[model samples]
Target: MNHMKRVLFALPLLVMASSAFAAGLAVTNNSGLPIDELFASPAGKGAFGANLMEGIKEGALDDGKTATISELASGTYDLKISAPDEGVLCTIKDVKVDGAALTLTAEQGKACK
Candidate 1:
């Protein structure tokens, strides 16, 4: 029937919408040092993708600032925060982003500095 066909067509779209809605990552900068770039990629991938959040005119992310990334698929990702000079400030591994949004905070410390 036409009604049955319509329901079948809409099922896939509904599933896609649900999956996309829950795939997001939020990064908060509390490292004291300014955040100049943000990198994310699948766990164990080693290579990081493009900057999810771009700085302002080569500037850095101020303290208490947050960046949201919604384009990534649902999976575990490794996150790295770096300074404007391309120095690694913080590295968080095995960040799971499943059917919900994940929040990551960068704290100030010897490891992060």
Candidate 2:
């Protein structure tokens, strides 16, 4: 039936749309210091939501390594990367993830040792 055909056609579109918006956060450690925590939350919010990667047991991200932050819905986010002793290494604001993942790196001033 024509109705059935339309439904079938729309199904792929839905899937594609969802996948397009599903790109998550990715952090690349360009700094020489190891990154112990990477947290992201909705922009303009008071607190960070959760750590995307680099936990206590798993160890931190070494220099020149990139890690992905899964389990986040696509949206604008504020990112924070911390040092091994909980010092603030870098803070990035207004990161947008629409159809592709957001990649962040610690450069110069933001790269605290």
TM per candidate? 0.55, 0.55
Encode model 2's per-residue lDDT on 41-97: one tens digit a residue: 789784886677734344787678766556566688777777756455666777776
Q: In model 1, which runs have C-alpha deviations exceeding 4 angstroms?
A: 1-25, 55-59, 85-90, 98-102, 106-110
The reply for model 2, stretches above 4 Å from the true place, is 1-25, 54-58, 98-100, 108-113
TM-score of 2: 0.55
Q: Report the C-alpha lDDT of model 1 over 25-111, residue by residue, as the tens digit.
A: 555566666677777788988889888765344356666676565466678878787775545566778877653444545433235
Error of 2 at 21 (Å): 12
Best by lDDT: 1
> Model 2 clash pairs?
none
Q: Show the lowest summed lDDT stretch of 10 residues, model 1.
A: 101-110
